[model samples]
Target chain A: MTTSDSSPTVRTPLYNLHVELGAKMVPFAGYDMPVSYPLGVLGEHNHTREKAGLFDVSHMGQAYLTGPDHDTCAAALEALVPGAVLTLGKGRIRYTQLLNSDGGIIDDLMVTRLVDDEDDGRLFLVVNAGCKHGDYAHIAAHLPAGIHLEPIEDRALVALQGPGAAEMFATICPEASEMGFMTAIRTDINGVDCWISRCGYTGEDGYEISVPEPQAEEFARLLLAHEAVEAIGLGARDSLRLESGLCLYGHDIDTTTSPVEADLMFSIAKRRREEGGFPGYGRVRSEIENGPKRIRVGIVPQTRAPAREGTEIQSNGETVGVITSGGFGPTYGGPIAMGYVSPEFSSPGCEVDLIVRGKTMPAKIAAMPFVEQRYYRKPKV
Target chain B: MSNIKYTEDHEYIRVDGDIATVGITDFAQSQLGDVVFVELPEVGASFEQGEDAAVVESVKAASEIYAPVSGEIVEVNTALEDEPTGVNSDPMGNGWFMKIKLSKASELDELMDEDAYKALVASQS
Candidate 1:
C-alpha cells in the first residue's frame, strides 16, 4: 500500500542494514520496507526453501496484557476473539483472528501464554503491521477494569524461516531446539534479551525472535553471519506464504471476509464452537454448519498467464467469484492463485475461467498449500 | 544493420526496411525484477501505437507492454514461451517479443535514438 507523501515514513532498527545490503526499498504499511535484495526475488525465494532466510518484521505490533491471573487475562482476550484462549496451555501459542461484532476479521494474530510466574496473569500478542493501531485501540477499549493492554513499542521482530532455520537458531540458543510448533520461550541470544517463538507465517519450521530495539541490529547480524542464513525481503516472504496457502491479512482475509468463508475454520477451537460467545459467533457458527455462500479456494490456471488480484472468475459463462491473491509461484514453477467462489464451485478439480485482462483463461479449483507444509511438531509420548 | 529506436515506456524497436522487431529495454527488465512469463500477440495481429500489445509477468508483479508503433505482427518469439527468463538475461537479443510490418515507416522518426533513450533512462533514475 502507498503512503501519502505528507506522512513521514518510519524505519525499523534494521533499515540501515537493508540499505547496506543494496536492497530495493519500497513503501509498505507506512514504512520503508525492503522488497528484495540484490540477489533478486526469485533467488531470494529459492534460498529460503533450501536455507534459512532472515526477515525483518519489526513493523508488526507486539503487546502484553496483564491481569490478576491467567483466567482474568484469558477472559479479557476471549471477549475480543473467538479462539479458546482461556484454555491455552502455558508456553503455548494459538493462532486466532480479532473479529468485529459482525463476525468479520479485524486482524489475524498469534497469542502466546507466558510461563513466567512473575507475569502469571499476562498474555503476549503479535499483530499485523497495518492493523496494529486499530487492533490495540479495540483491545484497550473492551478490556475489563483490572486487565491492562500495553504496546511493547521498544522491541523489534525478525523471522528466521525455512528448513535450516531451527538449526541456525539452535546454534544461538540451544534451548529453542526442544520447542514444538506453536510454542514460545523467553531466552537470551548472545547476551541480548529476547522472546523467541517456534512459529512463522511461511508454513515452514522456523523461529520469530523479538529483541529489544537497541540490540536488534547486532542480533540480526549475528544470525546473518551463519552460513545457512541469508537476508530475505518482503517479496520472497509473500511468495513463500502464498505457496504455503496461508492468508495475507488485507488480501485473502479482510473485514468483509469471515473465518469460515476464508477456509480458516480450523482456527475456531471446538470449545468456542460449542459455547459461542465471541463476536460474529452466530453468523460464523451458521456458516460452519450450513456452509457460507462463497468460500476461498486455491486456483491453478492452465496457462502461463498469471491471473493477478482482482481478476474475475467465471464458470460456464457465468461469473462466480474473483481472485484475491495471485502470482507466478516460483516454487510451483508456474502461475498460482487464491480466490473466493460460490460453495457449489469450490470443490477441487472443478474447472473455472479466469477473466485476465478480458480474456477467459481456463483454471481449476485446487487444494491449497500448493506445496506441502513442513512445520515441525514434537512426537506425542 | 537495423536502425534502433526507443519509447518512453521502455520498449525498443529495431527496424530493417518496413519490418520492426520489438522488445522491452534492459532498464524495464531490471525494474520488473524476475521475468517468469510473457503474453505476446499472435503473428498477423494488428495494433496501434500505445495500445496494449503484450503482458510481462515477473515474480513480483505483472506489467503491460505497449505497441511502440502501429503495425501488423509478422512474427513472435516462441522461445520466450519456454524460457521467459530470456527477457532478463538477453533482453535485446532472444528476448525480442515480436516483429511487426510497420503500417507507416515514418513512425520511427517519433522514437528516441540511442543517445536520447540513454538520457531518458538517466533522467528517470
Candidate 2:
C-alpha cells in the first residue's frame, strides 16, 4: 500500500477537490487517486451504510458504441461477452464482462441501452479504469463495418451511495425516486448535461452521475454541500464492495478468471447460455453444465485477525485455496474475505484454515454479501 | 514521559529501572489509521533487539512491532485482543503493547531521545 513515485501519474478532475478535503492521495491505476480522507476509511465505510457517501470514480472509462440499430450493435458486443446485450431494454443497464477466447474475463463493465430514438443504436459502456484503453481497442478492432466505438474522454464519474441516498435524491432529482435498480437517465443538473444511473458498486441504493470535466468539481461540491453526503475515498470503496461480495477487476477477477469460476454466472444471460455465440462459448457452456473445478466463495475468519490477500487457505492441513481480497469489514462486524476454493469446500460452514505468518487461523466458507444487499428493485406485480 | 525513549520505527520505551513499557507512538498509530487487531507476544517470550515481537493489523495492512531492545516479555496487554481501537484512541497510554524486563539496560542508549525523535518525525513531513 505504498504510494507510487517512480513514474508520474495522471490526476482526475476531483484531484484538487480531494486535496482540499485533506485526502491521502496515492497512485492507483495510472491516476493520482484518493485512498482516504480526514473522515478515515472505517468512518467512511460506516457513513456510507448510514448516510450517503460521495465517491469520485472518474478514472473509469466511459464510451459509446453506435451502429445502424440495436441489432447490429448488440451483435458486435455479444461476440465478446456472454451477456444478453441484444435483449437489453431502453434505459436499462446490464452488467457484463469482456472475455478472452480462453473464457477468461478481460474486464467487467456496465452497458446501458440508451432511451432516445435518435440514440437508438447507441450503447453506453463504463469499464474499469486500468483496462479501458485495451477494452476500447479490442471492441473497435472486432466491430463490423458501419459500427463505431467512441471513447468519451472528458467526463467525471461520481457515485452517491447509501441507505439515505434515495431520500437525498428525492429532494434534488425527484425523478430518481421512481427509478428501479440498474436504470439510467440523461438529464441536466443545474444546466450541466449529465448521465445519472440508479446503480453503484456499493450494494446500497444509490446513483452514479457522469458530469462533464469542466463542471465536475462544481457538481461534486454541490453534492458535498448536502448534509446527507460526505466525501468518501478509495479505501472505503474497496471495503464496501468487498462486503457487498462484488468483484474488483484486477484483485478478485482477472484475465485468468472466468465468469463461471468467479461465481458471476448471473451476468451470463440465459439466452446466451442456451444460444452460445460469445468468444469463449465452448468453455463457458461446458463449465455451466459440468460445473467449474474451483468456485469463488466468501470467507469469514473466526478470529479478529484478518486473512489478507495472498493468504493461503488450507483444509485438513492440505492447501486448497488462496485469498484474493480480505480485510476488516467495518460494517460486517469482523474480518471478511472472498477467494476461490475447491468445489467441495465452497459451501457455507465448510471449515478452512488461513495460514497468516505461519500461524493457522480458523475460518469458514460463509455466504456472500456478508451484509445483505439493499439494492432498490421495483416491485413486480 | 521524561524517561521515555523512541525508536525510528515509531515505538516508545518508557524505562523504570530495568523494566520498560513498550507501545507504538501516537504518530505511528495515526499513520496506520484504524487498528482492527493486535497480536501480543507471550509474557515469557524472549526477543532480541529488532526481532518481531508483536503484530498490529489495520484494515488495509498488517505491520510488525519490533522488539526495541533485547528483553524478556514481563506482561502483555490482553485487553487489546478484544478491543483494538485502544491502539488508535490511547496508543501511548492504555494501548501499550507490553512490559519488558531488559536483559541489558545499556541497550536504551542506542534509542532516540525525546528531542531526536521529535526531529525525526518533523523531518518526515
Candidate 3:
C-alpha cells in the first residue's frame, strides 16, 4: 500500500487550512479528508455532540436539475425516483432514494425545491461522496431532453452540526435561526454568497452551507474561529449518522435494497404511494402494501464488544441477516449498529445474536436514533 | 524503572527475571489513534515468538498484537478490557498490555534496546 502523496491528494480549496490545523489526512471517497484533527475521533465525536463540529464535506456531490417549469422538472425527477417530488414545498428538502428499474436503491439523496426560484424549475440535490460519479452518470442518461443536469464540482459543502450550531450560525446569518428543519435559504454568509440549509446527517440542530469553492478556505476559517466550532472527520461522521438512525449509501441502502426494505416509507408521500407512477413504482408499491421480506433495523449489543459491518446475524442457530453498519456510538455511550434482518425478527424487542469472531454475542432489535434526534424547528406562535 | 526492548512489529517488551511485561511503543499508539478495545490473551495460553497474541482495536481499524518473545501468558491487563484508550494515554506505564513468563531469557538479545529502538523509529518516520 502506498502512503498518500500530501501534495497530490486532490486538494480541495481548504486543503492547506486542514493541514495548518493539524488534521490527520486520510484518503476517502477519492479525496484526502481530515479523519480527525489533533483532538482525535473521540474528542471530535464528543465535540460535535456537546458544541459544534465543522465538517469539510466538499467531496460530496451537489447538483442542479433544470427544466422548463416546476411540473416539468418534478416529472423528470419522479421518473427516476420513488418519492413525490411535486409535493415538496419551496424551501423544503426531502430525503429520497434513486432507484434502478429492478427496485434496488441506486443512492439515497436529498432533493430540495429551490427556495426562491421554484418557478424557473431547478431542484437542488446533495448526493453521497462515494456514489456521486455513478449517480451523475445515472441521472444524465435518464433525464429528459429539455432537462439538464449540472454537477456543481466547484462548490464546497460544510456541515456545522451540534446543539450550539444554530446559535453559532445566528451570529453570522440571523435569518438562519428562523429556518426550520428541512428548510433552506440561498443568501450571503459572512459577506460571501452561499446557501444555508437547516439539515445535517448528525441529527443535531445544525446547518449545511454550500459555498463557492474559491471561498471555502475563508468560510471554514471563519467557522473554526468560533469558540464552539471544531473540525470533524469521516470517522465521526459515520458514528454520528449511525446513532441518528440515518441510512448511508453503499451500506444501509444499496443497489440490492429497496426503500421499503430500508424502512424509509416515511419519505414516500401519501399521494405517491397511493398513485404510483415513479420509477420502480410497481415493485415498491407492492412491497409497501405487502410488507418487505427483510427490513432494516437497529441492533444493540448485549456485550461491550461491537458487531461491525458484515457480522452475521442469527436466530435460534439459523442465519437470518447481515449487519450493514455497526460500531461504538460515542454519543450513546455504547455500541450501536444497523442491519437488515428477516421481517419475522424485525420488531424493536426481538432478540438475535451477532457472530463476532465466531462467538455468538447477544443483541436486541431496538428502535432507531439509538439516541433522540435534536433537529431545530419553528416555534408555534 | 525497567529497560525496554523493541520488537520488529512495534511492540515493546521489558523483561525482569522470568516475568516480562508487554506494551506498544509511543510511536505505535500514535499511529493507531484512540484505541477503543483490546482483546488480551487468556492467562496460561502458550505462544511462540512472533505469534499473534492479543488484538488491539482502534476506531478506524483492528490490528494484531504479536508476541515479542515466546512465553506462557502469565497475567493479561484486565483494565484494558474497559479502557483501551489507556494504550494511547499512557502506553508505557498503566497501558501495558500483558505479562508473560519467558521461556527463554536469550530472546531479549534479539530485540532492540532504547538507543537502537529510538534510531529505528526515527529512520522509519
Candidate 4:
C-alpha cells in the first residue's frame, strides 16, 4: 500500500515488465514489488506446481567473500554461521543461518563456493533482502585481514521453479537440468553470462539465476517466452514456501528463535554443533542438547478459515503459542499453517485451536510439508 | 434493484420491501482477487450497523465483511459453501451473502446511493 506522502519505493530492473504484465505492485522490504499478476495468486500457485513459474527475486542480496585461499574464506564464514563451511566443496551450496552470540539467527542464507580452479578463494552468497545490509556489515566486521566481503550491486536474481522448470531451463542451459540439487554453475543463456544454482525455495526442482543488471529485462523476457513458464508474484511465493514449510526470514525465524526451535537443526553442521565456535553457538548447542521449550510445527485448521500470522494458538483452553504463517493452501484444498507450540503438542495429529476473529477454531498439528516436495535428486548407484 | 445502495466498506444492499439482500460489491470482489472460502452469519442473528457480520477469504488473506445497516439475518446463502468462487463470478447475484430483515428501515437512508458509492470508489482508486 502507498500514500501520497509516503517515501518513494525503489524499483527493480523488472518493474516496467511487471507493469506491462498487469502486476499488482505493493511495497515490500523497501522496494516496489509485484504481489500478483493477471493470473492471480491461486492460479499462480497451482501453475507453479503443475508447470513452471518465473519469479523476480532480484531484491535479494548477492555478494562475494574472497580471501587468500579457500580455507581463509571458509574460516571467516565459519565464524559467523553455524554451517560447516570449511568442508564445503567448490560449486557445492550450504544452507545456514548467520547467528548472534546467543545462537539466535541473524539471517538464513545460501553460501556457495566458486568452482573454477582459479576462483577457489571466492565464495558466492545470497542473503535476504531485508537483512542484507546488516548481514554484510556483520560479516565484514567479523572478517580478519586477507578476507573481504564485497556486495554485488549490479545483478538481478530470478527463480524458475516447478516440474516443468527442467525443460524450460534445458532450452537455454542444458547443463542446468543435469545438475543435482544445491549445486551452482556459471553459465550463459543467449550469450548473457549467468550464475545459476540448481535450488529454489518452492520445494520443487528449479534454478535461481543471477544475471547482470543490464540484461535482467532481456533475460526475463527470454525465459517468459517458454511455454511452460508464467510470471509468478510475491503472493504465490509466500504461499508456495508456506506449503513447503519453509521459513520466511522475519516471520518464522528472527533474533528470538533459534534453529533447533524452528526445526532447522539440520542447518547446523554436526562438527560445528560439537566444537561450537560460531556466534550464538552456546544457545544453539544447549538447545540442541536440552531441547527448545517450543518447537515449530505445521498446523492444519479443520475449517475453511485460516489463522494468519500473529493469530493466537491455544491448547486445552490455555494460550500455548502463536501462528507464524497461515493461509489457504491452493494445492492442499484447505487452510494450512505453521507455528510454534509447546514441545508436547508438536507431534503430528495433536489437536489444538487457532484463534481467528475471536473464535477458537479447531486445528491439529500436522507433519509438513502440506504437500510432498519434488526436488530432483539423481539416483545413486 | 432501484433501491440498491452501498456501504463505504463495499457491501451492497438491494432493498425488496423490508427484506434486504446483502453482498460485497463487484469492485470489492475484484480487489480481493480469488475467493477461496466464506463465513456467513446464521439466520436470526442480529447485527448493529458497521458490526462484523461475515468473512470472505481470498487466497492471500481473510477479510471481514461488515454489515451495512442494523438488521436481523433472515436467510444465509448455502451455495457459497460448495462454490465459493461465486463471490468472484457473480458477487451481486448468486453470490449474495445474506438477507437481512431491517430492524430500523431508516438506517438505509444513511447508506450511499449508486452515484455516491461510485464517486467514493472513484476517489479511492
Give the TM-score, chain B only, in order for the candidates.
Answer: 0.97, 0.97, 0.96, 0.96
Worst 10 residues of 4 chain A by lDDT: A1-10
TM-score for chain A in each prediction:
0.98, 0.98, 0.96, 0.98
Docking class of 3: medium
Report how closely model 2 matches the true complex, as a DockQ value: 0.80
Number of the predicted model whose DockQ against the real structure is largest = 1
Cα error, residue A216 of model 3, in Å, equals: 1.0
lDDT per residue as tens, model 1, A1-381 = 323264677999999999999999887888889999988999988999988899999999999988999998998899889889999999989999999988999999999999677778899999999899999999999998999999999999999999999888888889988999999889877789989899997778999999999999999999999999899999999899998999998989999899999999899889898888888998998998899989999999999998988999998899999999999888888899999999999999999999999898999999999888899989899
If scored against the real structure, what TM-score would every candidate get?
0.98, 0.98, 0.95, 0.97
Misplaced by over 4 Å in model 3 are A1-8, B104-106
Positional deviation of A203 in candidate 3, in angstroms? 0.8
Kindly indicate the candidate among 2 and 3 with the higher lDDT. 2
Once fitted onto the true fold, the runs of candidate 1 whose alpha carbons sit more than 4 angstroms away are A1-6
Taking the true A–B contacts (Cα pairs closer than 8 Å), what share appears in each candidate? 0.86, 0.64, 0.36, 0.82
lDDT of 2 at A258: 88
lDDT of 4 by residue, A235-328 (tens): 9998899999999998899889988999998887779989988888778878888889889999999988878889999988899989998888
Candidate 3's residue-wise lDDT over A1-381, tens digit each? 112344555667788998998988887767888888888888898899999999998988999999998889988999888788887889889888999988899989999888886445899999987788899999999998999999988899999999999898889888899999998889987678888889999988899999999999999989999999998977888888999999988788889998899999998888888887777788898898888989999999888787888999999999989999998888887788899999999999899999987879999999998988999878999
Better of 2 and 3 by TM-score: 2
lDDT of 3: 0.88
